[model samples]
Target chain A: MPNAQRKTSKYVDGRWSIVSSQRPKAIRALLGVLFLALSWVGAQSPAEITKQVQANLEKSPWEATVSGKAQLPDGSSQDVEFRLQVLPGKEQVARVEFKKPGSLEGNFVVISEKEVWNYLFLTNQLIIQPRAKANVQGLGVNLTSLGDFDQLNEQVSLKLLGEERTAEGAAWKLSGTPKDKTQGYSSMEILVLKADPRPLALTLKDAGGKTVADLAFKGFKRVNLTAKQLKKYPADAEVVRK
Target chain B: MMPNVVHGVPNAKRKAQDAKRRTVWVVRPASYAVRQTLNAPSLGARGEAAGGEGWGGVFHHGPRATGHRPRAFCFWLPAIGHRLSAIGDFRGGIFALVVAVVAHVLATSQAQSLTVGLFAAPGYISPTLEGSLELGGFSLSARLKRDSLGLGVEDDLEFGPAGRFVFGARGDLGFGLQPLAWGAEAYLRGSVAQFGLDARLGYASAPRAALWAGERNFSGFAGNFNASYRLDPANTLRASLAYAGDVPGAIFQGSTLGLEGSWALREGGATYLAGLGFRVGAYALLGWRGELGEEGTLLDATLRLGWVNRLELGLFQEELRLRLMTTFPLGGVPFEAAASLEAESLRGDVAYDNANGRWTVWLRYTFTFD
Candidate 1:
C-alpha cells in the first residue's frame, strides 16, 4: 500500500508539471495572434496613403532649406539645395540652386500642376515647359497627379517587393510597369514610407534600360504659402516655354 | 662546138652544135595522157605540135647524154617561191579571223549580263532585295530599304502609321594577278526622298585591308586596311584596321578605329567562324553629342556556324547589339532563295530591359548570268 501511494503521488506531480509547461506555450501563441492582428489593422494601401499625402501637400504653406545628392547618367553626381514654399489655391514655388561638380550651376522652378521653369545661370536664360503629361512625346506621367485613390490603384499595378528601414525610418518598396503601353515611364520602382506613404525615392528607367531620371523627396509640412514667392522667378532663367 | 672545130666540121654540124649550145626549150603536147600522168595543166596544141618530137627529144636527150649542166636551180626556184607565198597569205588570213571572233564574243557576252530589282520592308522590319550585274571588271548594284517607325507623336495622338524608305547604289572594279587579287567599290546610299547621301570606297588585298573612302561632300573620309593569312590548307586568320571622319564643314564629324580577327573551321557539311572586334571612337556624332565626352568605345564579337549548301546560324554580341540569326535556303531559281529570321535587342544594351525587343525576318534570292 505504501509503494502504491508513493507511485500515485509521483504521477500526480508529473501531470501537474506537464500542465504548467503547456499553459505557457498556449499563452505565448495567444500573444503571437494578438500581434499579428494588430499588424494587419495597421497596414495601409499605398494608393490611399499617396492620395492623402498629396491632399496634405495641396493645403501646405511652408519654406525650408533642403539639400540632396542625385546620381546622374554619366556616373557622376549632382548635389542640390532648394528653398521651397507652397500656397493654398496657388502654385508651389521652389528656388533650386545646384552645387558641387563645377560643371552644373542652375536654378529651376516647379509650379504646381502647371510648368517647370529652368534658369541657366551661365546662359542667363530661362526655359519653361509644361508639366509632364501621361503621353509618350510629352514630359511624362506623374503618379502624384492621380486624385482618386481607387483610380490610381487601377491605373498603376503596384507590386510590393519588400520593406526596408532607412535613415528616415521603415519604407515599403513598390515596383510596377505601366499598364498602358503608351505611358512615358514604362517601368519604375518607388520607395514610400509605410507610415505616411510619401514617396521617398523614385527611379525612372526608359525602354532602353537607361535611367532617365531619379527623384528623392524629403522634409514635409502643412502650411500656407505667400503671393510674393509665387510671383518670383529667377533672374537669368532661360524659359523653355512649352 | 669545140669537138666540131677540131675536125673542121660542116656548116650543118656547126649549126647543130650551136643549136645544142643554145638553151634548149621543149614544149609539151596538150594531151589527155600527159595531163593525167603528170597531174599538170596542158599547154596549147598548136605550140606543142610546132615544136615537134625532134625539139622535145633533143631537149630531153641532149641534156642527159652530154651530162649537160642541169637547170636544177631554175626548177626549184618557182616551186619554193610559190610555197612561201602561199604560207604567208594563209597565216595573215587566220590571224585576222581570230581577232575578229574574239572581239565579237566579248561584245555579245557583255549584253547578256545585266540585271536589276527592287525590294521593300514593312513595319519596323526593313526588308530589302537588290540585284547586280558583273562584266569585264565592273559591277553595278542597287538596293532599297524601307521601315516603319510606328506610332509617332502625332500618330499616337491620331492613331496613324508612318514610315520611311532608303535607296542606294554601288559599283565595283576588280583586277587580279596570280595568287593576288584586288578590288575597289564605291557606293551611294540615301533615303529615296531624303536629304543625305553616304558614299563609300572599298579596296582589298588578295584574301585579305582593302582600303575604303567615303565622299567628301556627303559625310566623311574613311579608310580601312585588312590582311588575311592562311594558317593551313583549310584555316585562315584575318586582321583589319579602319578609320572614318566627317569632311570639313559637314554637319557631323567623328572618327573610329577598329581591329578584328576570325578563325574558320571547314569540315563536314558545315563551316564555323568566330571573331571578335573592338572600335574606339565616336559614332552617330549628331545625336547626343553633348552627352558623350570626346571618346567612346565599342566591343563586338560574333560566332557563325553554317551548313555548306543549306543553312547558317550566327550570333553577334557587342556594346550596341545582341542578336541571333538563322538562315535557311530554299533552292530554286532566280537562284537559290533564302529566308532569315533574327531576334535582336533594339537598344544594344547587354542588360535586360523589359521595355523593348525586335524580331526580324527577311527573304533573299540570288541570280547569276554570264
Candidate 2:
C-alpha cells in the first residue's frame, strides 16, 4: 500500500509541472499578438502616410502669414511677404495680398480651379491667365490645393525621406521626383509633422538641382472666411482690362 | 494649440531666424546684384551707337565712345578646359564658333531633348524646337527658333555645380525671309558668386527692308564685367563696365566702353519667382562710344518697370518703350504673342538721329510643339 501511494504522488507532481510549463507558453503567445497589433497601428505605409497628410490638411479653411524666396534662372533671388487667405471648401480659391516691398504693396493675386488672375495696383489691369496642370510653385503651395497629393503622386515618384526635427516640430520628410523629367518641378521635398502630418515646409528644385523656390509655413491657423471675402476681387469700374 | 492660435515658431527658433536675417543683411550686400550686362554685342542696328552692338541687342545700349587705345586679351579656364577670347578680328569669331560647337558635341553625348516657347521684348516672337543632352553638371542644348523676324538656330551649353562655378556658351545663326537679313552670334557667360563676366562675337547684315530702305549692318565683339551685391531680399546694387570692338567685314569700326550702376528692386507678391515678379530698375550710365572712326564720351540714364512677368515699360534719355507679352496653351501646344512700341525724341547728343520724335510699333507671335 505504501509503494502505491508514493507512485501516485510522483505521477501527480509530474502532471503539475507540465501544466506550469504550458502556462508560460500561452502568456508569451498573447504578448506577441499584442505587440504586433500595436506596430501595425503605429507604422503606416507610404501611401497611407500621404493619405493621412491629405486628410489632416483638408480639414478646413486656413490662413497664414507667408514669407518666402524664389531663385531666378540667372542666379538671382527674390523675397516676398504676404497674407494668404484660403477657402478650401467645394468652391476653393486662394487670395494673396502683398505687404512688403512698397512697390507691390497694393498688388493682389487670386487663384481658382479654373484660372489665375493678377490685379495690378498701379495700372489697375486685370490680367487673366490660363490654368496650369499643377500648382507646384512654392508661393502657391499650401493646404488649399485641390487633388494635391493625387496630382503629385501621379506625376512623381514619392518616397519617405525619414524622420527629422524641424522648427515647427518633429516631422517626416518626403521627397518626390518627376517620373517624366519634363515636368516643371524636377524634384520637391515636403516636411510633414509626425504627430499631426501637416505640411510645414515645401521646397521645389529645378533640373540643375538649384532651389527654384521654397515656402516655409509659420503661424498657420484655421479661420472662418466668409463667402464675400472669397469672392472675386473688387476692382473699380474703371479697372483696366488686359 | 487651438485652431485660432496664431503664434509663430518657438522662441529659440525665432532667435535663430533673426540671426540668419542679420547675417544675410551683412553678407548679401557685399555681393548681391540682380542683373548685370555682360558685354555681348548688341543684336540691333541701334546698338552700335550705345556701345552695345553684340549678342542680345534687344533692350539696352552702351556708351558711344571707346578708350584711348584698342586693347585685346584672351584667357583660358583649366578647370573646364575652356579657352575664352574677346576676338576683335573676324578670324577670332570663326575660331570661337568652331571651337564652341566642337566642344559642345564632344562634351555632351547623353543629352535630353525638349521644346520651349518664349516671347521676349523688342518684338521678338520666337517659337523654339530644342534638343539637349546632359551629363553630370554639363549640358548642351540646341534650338531652332521661328519668329516674325526670321528663322534661326541657337545653341547653348553650360556646366558647373550650383552656388559655385558656372560656365555657359551660346551661338546663334539667323536668316530673315521677308527682309532678307543674315546674322550670326556667339556669346559666353561665366559667374562666380557676386561677380559675373560675359563676352560675345556677332555679325548682322540686313539689306533694304520694309522699315528702312538702306542696308543696315554691324559686326563686333563685346565684353562685360560686373560686380553686384544684394542689399536685401528685394533689392540689388550693381556696377558694370562694358567694352565693344568692331569686327572685320562690318561697317561699324569704332569701339566703346560704358560704365553703369544699376539698382534693381523687386516685389515677389505678384509671382513666386523673381523672374515672374514685379520688377523695377534704375540705371545710371556713363561711357564713351566711337562711330565712323570717331570717338566721343556720352552719359545717359534709364528706368525700367515690369508687371506680371510680362508687361514692361522702359524710359531712357528722351525715349519711352512699352512691351506687352502673354503666353497660353492651345491644343497641347504653347503660343505667345507680344507687342513692343518705342517712342523717341532726342534730348542730348544721342546715338541715333531721332531729334524729331518717332514711334516704332511691332506685333509678333510664336507657336511651339514637342
Candidate 3:
C-alpha cells in the first residue's frame, strides 16, 4: 500500500512576518537570483512527481499496514485497519486483509487484474466477481487506489500544491480533483515522501467537504511475494464465483 | 445488528460484574451438523461404509470423539487446550474467562488481534461451558462438556508440503467438541495459479463405539486426488476421484469420481452462488448447493440425490436429502441454524425411522468480540 501517516486534523496557519526598515538593494538582488535558480532546478511538474512515485511503488512486491477513520457508505465514521499487499507485474494483483472493525476482522479481499475475491471468515466462503462488477471502493472511499498510483492518477487530476519537511524527509503535497463527477470523493490531498518517492498519507473529502477517509501507511517494505502465495486461501473454503 | 458495547460507568462494582455480564452474552461459534445412516441398497454390500462407526480405531468424522477442534489456528488449539485444562477447574467456567482476559491483554499489549467468545449450553445432556480465543494465526478453544467433564478437543490441521490451507472439525456427536476422543489427522491442500490440489489422511480412536469411531469404520482410510481449475473469473470446476479409504477427503464422501463446478452469477445487482456436482462411487451421488438471495443471501440450500450406507442392513439405500442453512439476528445476537431432512420416500417407505427417513437440526449463537 502507499506509504502514509494521516496528517493530524489540527492545522494552525502560524506564519512569522519579518519586516525590515532598512533594505539593502544588492543583497536583496542576490537573494532573489539565488531563489529563482533554486526554483528552476528543484521544482518538478505534478505529472513527473506522480509518475516517479508510481515507478518506485511498482518496482517490486510490497506490503503495508493502513489504519485510520474512514467514512462508511452511510456517512458514519468508523475505525478501520488493514494490511495491503501489491504484487506488481504486467497484471497487478493486490491482497487486503482487514484487521480492525471487529466485524470485518479476518475478512480478506484479493483483487486480480480481472476479478475481485471477497472471502468472509465467518462462512468460510469466497465470493468472487468480475472486477468490473465488484465495488472495490471501501468505506465510501477508493482504498485500493492507495496501492496503485496509476489508478489514483486515472481517478483524479493531481497538482503539486507545495512541499513540507517531516521526520521521514521532505514531502511533496499533492491536491487531486476527481475527474469523474460521481466519484466517491470530490477531492483528496496526498503527502508523498521525496526521498522514497511514495505516499505517506492521504485524506479524502466528499463533495460536502466532509472527511471521507484519513488513512496512514506504515511498515512498508518489498518482499519476495509469489503469485501462488497471493492466491492462497483456505482450500476447503466454499468457492462462489460471480 | 449493532454491537452492544459495555457502556456503563466504570467503577469497582461495575467492573466486578462486567465479566459476569459478558458471560451471559458471550456465545460459542455456530456449528452445523448432519448425521444419520445412508442405506445404499442398490450398491452391493455397502453397509460397512456407514458412519455409525463403533470404536476400534475406526476413523469417524464424529466431533464428540475429537481430541482437538480444527480451526484456523489448529496448530495451537491442542497445546493451549491442554494448558488451559491443566490451569484449574473447568467445571466452574472460570478458566474460560481467564483465557479470554489473558488473551485480550496479550493482544492489546502487542497490538495484535484477538477474538474471545464464551457460552453455556444447559439444554444439552451435559452442562456445557465453552470458550475460544483467537490471536492472529494461533487459537485456543475449549469446552467443558458431558456429565463427567469429558472435554475432547477435536480438529485436524491439514498441511501440504507447501503450506497449510485448510483445517476443520465435524459436529458428528453434535457440537463436534468432545472430551478426549483421541483422534488425530494430518493433510495438505493448496493451489498454484488456477490448478488446485488436495490430499488428506486421518485416524479415529474414540473411547467407545457409540461415543466415537465405529467398530469397523468404513470411512477410515479415506483418500482422494482432487484438482480444481478456474474456468474464468466467475466459474471454477473441480474434479475429484476418491478411493475406498481416507478419513476426510475433499471428495471423500465415498465418491469414486466427483465432478463439481461452482458459479457466481450477478443478477439484479445481487450475487447468487450456484453449484452443480455429482459423485460416482460404489453408489452414485449428485448434489449441489445454492444461495437463496432475497434482499441479500437469505438462505443456503443443498439438494442431493444419492445412495447411503446402511451398516446394519448391509445394503445401499436410495435417498434424497435437502438441507437448509440460515443466519438471523435475535435480540442483536446472530444465530446460525441448519436443518437437513433426508427421506427414502422414493423407495416407497416414507417412514421417519432408523432405516428410512432421517433428519438433523443444528442451532448455535455466535457472540464474538475482539
Q: In terms of docking quality, how is candidate 1 classified?
A: incorrect
By summed lDDT, which 10 consecutive residues of candidate 2 chain B come out lowest?
B23-32
Q: Score the docking of each candidate (DockQ).
A: 0.01, 0.04, 0.02
Q: What C-alpha lDDT do the candidate models reach, one value each?
A: 0.31, 0.38, 0.42
Candidate 1, B1-370: lDDT as tens digits: 0111211344355444434431111111111101100000001011111111111111110011111111111122232233335454543444345335534544555422211122211122223223232235333232222210000010001000000111222222111112222333332321111011122344333111100100011112344333333343234344444443221221112213334444444344223344444432111100000112222221111221211111111122212212221212222101111122212211111111111121122333323333
For model 3, residues A1-242, the per-residue Cα lDDT tens digits are: 11211121111111111211244777656655654564553466667778888899889999989889987654678888888898998878889887766545546788888877776543344656567756656765544455767777778888777777877887888888889887788989988888889888888898889899898878889998886677766432444333
Alpha-carbon deviation at B328 in model 2, angstroms: 39
Name the runs in model 3 displaced over 4 angstroms: A1-38, B1-370
The residue-by-residue lDDT of candidate 2 on A1-242, one tens digit each, is 23323433344345455555666877756655654563444344456667887676667877777667755335566775677777766776777766543335545566677665555332223444335522323232322242356556666677765556787776767788878776556888877777776777778788788776686767878899864575444221011111
Quick one: best lDDT, which candidate?
Answer: 3
Clashes of 3: 46
Using lDDT as the measure, name the better of candidate 2 and candidate 3.
3
- Candidate number of the best DockQ: 2
True contacts kept of each: 0.00, 0.00, 0.00
- Report the error of model 1 at residue B250, Å: 36
